[model samples]
Target: MPPSPVVPCHSPVPDPSLYEPINTLKPVVPDVWIADGPVVRMAMPCGLSMPFTTRMTIVRLRDGGLWCHSPIAPDDALFAAIDALGPVRDLVSPNQLHYAHIAAWKRRYPHAVARASPGVSERAAAQDIEARFDAAFDDAAPSPWPGEIDPLLFRGSRAFGEVVFFHRASATLVLADLIENFEKEKLTRGMRAVARLGGVLDPDGKAPLDMRMTFTDRGAARDCLRQLLAWKPQRVLLAHGRWYERDGVEQLQRAFRWLE
Candidate 1:
């Protein structure tokens, strides 16, 4: 049997629109799940902080070791619920901007290897954030979960890169920052305007305009996008904003239409 979708909790959140009942696993499919977390304030280049709704994906590998992607802020009850699922063996940081909580998770699961995308180390150092990774993702899939999950190193941007994952059994695609779909109602008026300007608001969310500017080599990004499309995922999970539970391929194509 698959793990329960949620664990009982009573704490109230400031914004239910941001996906309430936070920090509990919600099953997406058998052996695959997602946990929505509280909003995190992200500093922007414009000298202001932007609020982003956080989410994380969890996959229970065939061997019983859990693969955690872009783990959200750690919570005691959440950790206990995760403990019931299985042993955590992989803590994955999908992109340079999404590794903030890996250090904390690593401290809790010492045996789990923290894997990162390119440039994460430098980013952490520049930001003065302590993020230690035991392994780095490259062109080839790494050990432990290769046959079960497909890993892709999305290249092209010299300053930004992401390691995308696909869970074969669940037909789910896990991404960080590639596409963000913030629901308008969930966001404050100012944030909604900002999100609209960033091209990340729901129903039409794409890569942030600023992030798109970093991809000087659109060909390389297009190549990676091709691979992602070929995966034919049925569900797509994002680290921020609303996730697509169906029509994953269509959503991917829609989100990346800007690449064409």
Candidate 2:
């Protein structure tokens, strides 16, 4: 028997009209849309902080397929935008704990494949939702992105698994819930103090704390970090907080300094 279905904590959806359509030609990292034919990166700004803040990324495959890294409950307008773009090919629950809107996405896109980490199967089963994956991410796991992207599983801790994705064509790395970048003024006073103490805040004001908590074994994390660094990606797309542009690999090294 599967574990009981876990209903995600509910939150109101943000109005889409409030967001201005960002021109992709610009070079802003936070809400920049990078597209190369069928491969499109839509940087939707989240309401994590006031005055246009983004905490997650929604990637669109060539077939108009959608894949989200972070959980943001898709409202009608959001779904319409997704529909306008193309069909949602897959929904990935990168870690065990981040399945906030998997069920809803499954309902919305019934044909879309729902892939999750090891424990996600039971959670999906409990909810009576069917999830399909080519394989669970093991060491050096392969992604199902049809040669467009590759996934490397960073194994070292049991609390959660962080599957890192590398988009080959764009030389961009997609990370989930691992690194966070929040401006101090945008965060609440309490959060600011905690982030500062956690060494999440970089000199450029980026936060990597989201990825730091999952490392039960530093050795494993260090090895994974080393492997990821070898890719030499130019852009870093993260699920939480902000994405890094230029010197992404160096920023990643700085964030995972425990490995050093």
Candidate 3:
């Protein structure tokens, strides 16, 4: 059942303390504020990379609850910071590979609804991760973020499926693993070599070759890309790399050009 629970190849968990916090008051995207919530980033060691930065987009909903997207390892200090914003209502695992920290955040906020994308539950089960997903993202926007954020299911990648979001107020497109923009300077020598081979390093971020090759149905991928283009988001945020602060729509087009 459930395709025998396909485990993601890139899933790994290290000490949360290994992460160096980069929380700031300023908006990550120019003038795109999320109430009083701050976008916190943390660098974690994994694979060939000595350390890679992951960003968590915290948005305050109309009901005074925090919606955390692609959450990173939550330490006590991070918890305090999150508490200052409001009660945590939603903890999102944007893709299969990013669910390692979902359980941790849920433990901290018992009332928070942890939502995962398609293929996450099985992968977590296969990997022995105790992730209890209260809900799963589909094509529809979640009730808490209605009209504010839109979710698009990235299809055709037999490796796994991921949900991409477009934040309307900020005109920001949020993605996990669909495209990467790692700055060469931030990667160690070994990681630089590995990233180069993976074809995910910057200038123009593109999907990894392995992932691109997994898509047997090109039509589905292209359809998702077309919908993304229609959203016209001004900024694009990637989970594992530098985000595009300007011309988000154009950047997305360039990144997914291979799908065409």
Using TM-score as the measure, which candidate wins? Answer: 1
For model 2, the run of ten residues with the poorest summed lDDT: 35-44
Candidate number that wins on TM-score, 1 or 2: 1
**Candidate 3's error at 101, in angstroms?**
1.1
| Order by lDDT, highest first | 1, 3, 2
What TM-score, computed on C-alpha atoms, does each candidate reach?
0.92, 0.69, 0.81
Positional deviation of 17 in candidate 1, in angstroms? 4.3
User: Across residues 115-184, which tens digit of lDDT does each residue of candidate 1 receive?
Assistant: 9888898899999999989998877646447679998888778678888898999899999999999999
Q: How accurate is candidate 1 locally (lDDT)?
A: 0.90
lDDT of each: 0.90, 0.58, 0.74
User: Alpha carbon lDDT of residue 203, candidate 3?
Assistant: 78
Stretches of candidate 2 off by over 4 Å are 1-54, 62-64, 121-141, 202-216
How far is 182's C-alpha from truth in model 1 (Å)? 0.4
Which candidate would rank higher by TM-score, 1 or 3?
1
Error of 2 at 31 (Å): 14
Candidate 3, residues 98-122: lDDT per residue as tens digits? 7888888888888999998888899
The lDDT leader among the candidates is: 1
- State, as a TM-score between 0 and 1, how close model 2 is to the true structure: 0.69
